[model samples]
Target: MSQDTQPAYRRILLKLSGEALLGEHHYGVDPAVLSQVAEEVCELSRRGVEVGIVIGGGNIFRGAGLAEGGVDRVTGDHMGMLATVINALALQDAIERAGRFCRVMSAIRINQVCEDYIRRRAVRHLEKGRVVVFAAGTGNPFFTTDSAASLRAIEINADLMIKATKVDGVYDADPFTQTDARRFDRLTYDDALERRLGVMDTTALVMCRDNELPIRVMNMFAKGDLQRLVMGESVGTLVEGSRQ
Candidate 1:
């Protein structure tokens, strides 16, 4: 589609996992993956689709993983939140280098580094066509970044939440373990919940369901997947309140 063409959705909340930033590595940010992601985001932004990203921290630290190692849950979660900030900063830098103005807003106060998150301010940034990166995961210890994404998407009144995953779409069973696992092109929120599809955390999925928000689960590294989605092409599984 041309840059002047209207995108299928006016605005979107892009949820990225910290693991995705690792690319081929086992830990930390990979420069190549970061560049590719930045380019994809820049393309979408330049084409007039407002973008807000909520990224996870598993690549650096995961509270749940730390807790299993006997670390204090709250302390580990705080560390995880900080890891997310690190990622958000890196992403903001990449976005700027990609030629789009970007803002990093944290749910927790880190006045020295990033702006404190304000819903109105975020909305205004999107209105001005600036990409917004939300960090720190809802400022709560227990909640995952997925919850933050859902909450922010609803607050921003986004057309949909795009969850960039390693898998192409939601499967009826675990794709890695089940050779016969079936992928759904679309499904209702209730069905996803009843079948225990681990597309998103329970809290996040429930929040989206209650608000009637739709979610698209797509492979982040898939070539042109984001563009196809913005252009209304079938790229991944669509989960909504009903089969729309």
Candidate 2:
């Protein structure tokens, strides 16, 4: 597909924060939000883009917070991983309910439920135009869904990684707190690092830069923002440069 004739990305990795599934609530998965997401994703698939998704488990579990209260780190991480599975299941169901085919693959062994994360199987699923949802945070402790998103993006050879976020783009400071922060339409990895931006973790950014994958950070909750961003419109901050 040519840029002038088709969708901007042939394949894409979508990183959805668990908080995004909350709709108006600050926590937990909301059915309505999940349905809306399904609608959006179905629309994207109909337009001929291969979509692979990675959803965070923050709403159901946040390991870092659990560890602060004296819970065993590994236990907390496992809980976090399970939380991601729950979200993945919800997303899978929602997507299917929207009448699109999809597969839920888990990094951890949960064969009775979702397919174990196998790189080739995942690629095959996407190639068939089925949305693939990756869950369980790389089946390891101390890694984040951000890192998992990057890993999947590379493994599947996605054209871009889309971070669906609360904000439209990367700002110099917290937009909710800093009135003076400037919103960027585009940026380089070095510039983001020098400014201490929190668009993604250092590891995720470095991996993307190293792989030379273009990343777009956008407020997906906004109406049609995902479509706009995926179509290569200026809907968010496009992080440019080689992978670090």
- Among all candidates shown, the one with the greatest TM-score: 1
Instruction: Please give the lDDT score at residue 226 for candidate 2.
Output: 91
Global lDDT scores for all candidate models: 0.94, 0.90
Lowest-sum lDDT 10-residue window in model 1 = 1-10
TM-score of 2: 0.95
User: 52-132, model 1: which lDDT tens digit per residue?
Assistant: 999999999999999999999999999999999999999999999999999999999999999999999999999999999
Off by over 4 Å in 2: 1-5, 242-244
Global local distance difference test of model 1: 0.94
TM-score of each: 0.97, 0.95
Judging by lDDT against the true structure, name the best candidate. 1
What's the number of clashes in each of the models?
0, 5
Residue lDDT tens for model 2, 1-244: 2335578789999999888888878788889999989999998898889999999999988888899999988899999999999999999999999999999999999998899999999999999999999999889989989989999999999999999998999998889998998999889977777777988888888899888888899988898899877786788899989435
**What is the lDDT, from 0 to 100, of the residue 102 in candidate 1?**
98
